[model samples]
Target: MPRWRSRTRAERRLAAEQQGHRGEALAGLLLQMKFYRLRARRFKTPVGEIDLIAEKRGAIIFVEVKSRGHQGSEAEALGAVNSARIVRAAQYWLARHPAESGKDMRFDVIFLAPGRWPRHLINAFSAS
Candidate 1:
């Protein structure tokens, strides 16, 4: 009988999307606080989309942001990420920005859950 229980499928989907956007914003802010310059928020390529792109000390970082409703679901949220798709997207991004090709690049993930600080996993995955 909760209000959320009454939400239609579309409503739930919209709410999820909103939550995802908020998570990405929070993640970007976290990166900035750590001296990382944000290059893009949502970088979409023909292959896929990267939630965030950042740079620090001449290193390019491709980040995937994942959010969940409760604490202790970090692993579950991380499991949802498709590293291969993100890697392909990063490749496409690099093709357009040839300047970044020679820079040291890595993949990262920022996990978010209610009542917890953002968890930043650096070098969380690799393109190889």
Candidate 2:
């Protein structure tokens, strides 16, 4: 078993939070390299929150960042529940930014694991 498997709930929470931060950082850097303009980070709405929002070439991307010490859980982290939340949050975001409402939107997921490069999945899910 992994060391985290033995950790308490609170410990695991803290570790997860730290991992999320690191993952977001890496994702942001990757987006920057791709020349995407970051519009938001940790965007919050009444329904849910989006980890990152970036725009490039008239398209806006809503990104979900997930980090785990084990790569196996990456798929689990990007499950339906998470995608639904991101869609809801993105809706809220678009409502608040009416000027950008006409732009094309895409949902993306960035998975991070220890000692591995961050993997960005574009158009990973959809609101529909």
Candidate 3:
């Protein structure tokens, strides 16, 4: 039985938001475990938003997180990511932190579905 089936539309939206926050927290932990230093969460710019920003080995990663109630949708999550928007946001972020400008940067996506292991796709897209 899907819990959402019992929720009203507003309740469902709230639940989804809460779930997304949980997913982002979990994703951050996972990235830390992988030796990525967390930089920011829910980073926003006039151009767009990035769910998480992390760095490892001179590479800055701009991540988009997608949470679902269903499993095995990592590939589908990729489809939900707006690479161009993220790139623009990353550019804005770097502009604010000039010291990071010379470092390598890439966009990534993290998929989190209940009761399933999170999937992280590194260097998922390029700024070009």
Question: In terms of TM-score, which candidate is strongest?
Answer: 1
The residue pairs in collision within model 1 are: none
In order of listing, the candidates' clash counts read 0, 0, 0
> Quick one: best lDDT, which candidate?
1
TM-score leaderboard ranking: 1, 3, 2
Query: The CA-based lDDT of model 1 is what?
Result: 0.92
Please report the TM-score between candidate 3 and the true structure: 0.88
RMSD of 3: 3.3
Tell me the tens digit of each residue's lDDT in model 3 across 1-128.
65555768999899988888898999999999999999999997999988999999999999988888888557777887888898889999999999999998988888888787788887888899
TM-score of each: 0.93, 0.87, 0.88
Model 3: lowest-lDDT 10 consecutive positions: 1-10
Ranking by lDDT: 1, 3, 2
TM-score winner, 2 or 3: 3
